[model samples]
Target: MSLDLDYLKLKIELFLLRKKAKKTFPEDLSNLTLWSQSTGLKVAVIDNDGFNLKTNLESIGVSVTVFYDYFKPVSQRQEKRKPYPFSQYDIILCDINDVASGNDGFGELQGVGAIEALRYNFPFKMIIAYTGNPAALSRRIKKEKSSNLVDKIYDKQWAPEDFMETFKESSKSFSNPEARWQFIRNRLTYLDAKEKEIDKIREAFVYSCLLKGNPKFLLRADAELENLTQSTLKFLQQGSMSDALRSGLSGLGLISDVFGIVAAIKGT
Candidate 1:
């Protein structure tokens, strides 16, 4: 499907709003699990240090299986100790820091190898690479075409809280895909318009600050300019910025003056 700017804008706005609202975390996964009955979510966690995660997953009512380094080997002894049949779970949560200990150790199994194994062994399941090494995980995902294997990649620092937030948002959005799409479209449109207005405000502010010739004002204006540039770049990277805006306003049937204004601000 084509990218919908309005939809993208809405998603971002809602995300920001949610952050501001500070939604309470469900005591456990009780509400989430009940919600999942209609959604049919079966979660599994794999971590060398799984004690806390295991408890949290269980509290949410997900049937969780933990796989530590010592337990990863396929040796007869390790095979005997495998907790849950690999085929039992719908989702797998793997830790990147896990290191096998026995003669049949799986080594570090950090980057692409572990993801490959999970995909090769269980074609039906989804894997969430929960790691402390987010930079490495991101790099691996970028280099490989294993997006199909990984449903999500989360760093350990943000796993519990961020994952929960993402799950809740996805669950809510997926409930009615059509409505969600429309909502997103509208939001993107609003964001595009808002961005233009903000750009104009920024240009005027910069001119005033520079004209006043106040060092303190100039410094503040410079900081504001940096922030605006960064924000614009972020939207462009995410494909949330409007094509019309990127192509220049004249092409989008906007007043050429708006384009000139934006360009002037950018130049400064």
Candidate 2:
């Protein structure tokens, strides 16, 4: 019927499915699997060599969204390159030497500037600087640490185990369900623009459904997803975000990737 009702229905269905998944899943499997898609700690690795490090992080249950070529999104349009973005990632591992491209207005210190910006944007989240050369931690880096602009400065060359250990020591607010549905809760969150709006709806659905699987809302999750997906919007942006959210829920294991109890009725 209405957009709001539509949205709620998708959420309720997703919630019910997760509950069902939990009950029927074998005991040997970690309950963490159900939560891994979204409700766990997520990380963003912004080194030129981030992918190399990404493999290590994933092994440790860290879902990493990496940025290289100056922390810009790979395969994305050039216009989306400016701000560099901070995903829903709980932790940030940034390399200082060559990534920011002066977006932060600091030439050699752009990474430090990014840290400042990230700290400002997410005051409560953990931001770690990948101090490539530990022997030469820069003056600006040290200053930020003293002032707490960054939670920690870690060397990339360190053993993976040691790095994560250091990462854990740097913040009290971070955690890993080791959980990947861990949606890594990959939300700032995955990338930008029209696509960004769409993803936000997607993330909100997964994040909310997993955390608040209340039955009361089940009556009208309709307000929440389905109608929102089909609603004739004056603006494309409004449509994309909600529709994208419905799509995201399906990816996370909703009853229908088609996204709604209404199902094929929309086409008819």
Candidate 3:
């Protein structure tokens, strides 16, 4: 996994990883028809990247949410920030440096660390590295072990044609239901570290609540938005969420009745 490997090794590793992905991924292309007619992909843009690619990306159909200074939500740089719901995003584009004001081991390149965390915890989602500094990628990817996880890298100065091509390749996973499941499950592992009585939360939300909708999967999504930090939602300023993804989690019953059931489970 060392970044110092020769070009041959790099190509070999990349090939193997990509091959493994193609072979092991769970798929159900039946919903693909739903995608083309929908609002395109759900994109989370870390560090904003100005408006350069935003309008262009939207033109092709993706709904983008810019978490302007994700890592440094507060004035204090010591605090580690929380990511939004995994099921909420389809693709994540992150910059490697100058992401607001903070450092959680990645120093000025905190976005790389943030991207690494997202990739490790949610492996199935499409993650693209978008940055003005390629040198920062060399410096940060090595330390973060994120070289292979990123699907593609788009320089901030990339030509319109180049970015359009990148989008074409990256959006292929939009039709993947299995990949979406992995994204949700892995996020639970990360959330478990901070939330208490997670199993209870899942049961109350999914079986009782979510079962109302996607009964096939007993995974419940929380009804109480209180469990999520204000910053997580606040940062999603212009989040253009799609109805297709009202929630990877869906449920029935009164929000009061369903949410009241899990209200006491502290730290969720």
Candidate 4:
């Protein structure tokens, strides 16, 4: 509910902003579908408060592995156990301030330092930074955006409901490539049939446009899709660049046509 409020507020704000300015790209390019498929999802948490979160996630059927800090060398720490292989996780929730101290492997890695180390070591993994300090977290998020290191940033104090809701939505979308493509196809097929949620339909249309080489839409669809669509489109575009992911999206079906999707959105 709390997470939904933010999205509701965003929709309302976008609707108002659209009236004043020519439709342009949105500042926030968040793709809710990246974690769309969460069945049997693998998650790793690297935070001081990860135990509670890990327990909660596990109750909901999520496979979660918690680690305090990987920056420390095995020789320094008494727990000489095998660490959770970061490569196997679908999502990683990390705290920027959860750092390592003296005589550590990574040399006192803290905050952005820890985040960067994880990003470098696990480039393909989805990393999210969670911290109490919004300002510091935002800075870390921005720094990683160029490299797609961090998929999202949440406040460490996020309400239980909000965080869970967000996690569920993301996980549902995190399905395999074929499922993702099927989802896109289903949304496309219903674009014209769904009359009430025109806003949602337009959003899907905009996201689906990323498959095409160029975007072309009529006046109505163009007006319906403004910043929100642009932002989602950009994120998906970046995500689709990986060879495995691209093949997954394109292998099953020739990426959906942009013009057709635009027309469907316009009901033309």
Go through the candidates in order and give each one's C-alpha lDDT. 0.45, 0.49, 0.49, 0.50
Task: Compare candidates 1 and 4 on lDDT and give the better one.
Answer: 4
lDDT of 4 by residue, 1-268 (tens): 9989976776565455444233322122234222224546788878755557767787787898877764534655576544345766767777766443332443322656666656655533457776777676565456656435465677767888888888876554344333333444443332222322323333454343322212233333444444445453445445424443333233111222221232224322
- Structural similarity to truth (TM-score) of each candidate: 0.42, 0.45, 0.48, 0.46
lDDT tens readout by residue for model 2, 81-147: 5556663556777777677763746766567666766765554345778877654555765655644
TM-score of 1: 0.42
Give Cα distance to truth, residue 184, candidate 4, Å.
Answer: 14
Tell me the tens digit of each residue's lDDT in model 3 across 1-268. 3654664564464344334433332342223222242254678888745546778778877798887755535446556665655435667888777553445576766777677676665544567888888776876567767455576677888899888886775554343333333344444343332233323333333322222223222222232233322222232222433332223123322222222223222122
RMSD of each: 20.0, 12.1, 18.3, 15.8
* Residue 247's lDDT in candidate 1: 41
Q: How does candidate 2 fare on TM-score? A: 0.45
Which ranges of candidate 2 are over 4 A from the true structure? 1-39, 69-81, 102-105, 135-138, 141-146, 168-172, 175-268
Evaluated at residue 123, the lDDT of candidate 1 is 38
Q: Where in model 4 is the C-alpha error above 4 Å?
A: 1-36, 76-84, 103-109, 140-147, 176-268
Model 4, position 268, has a per-residue lDDT of 21
Q: Rank by TM-score, descending? A: 3, 4, 2, 1
In candidate 2 the C-alpha lDDT for residue 263 amounts to 21
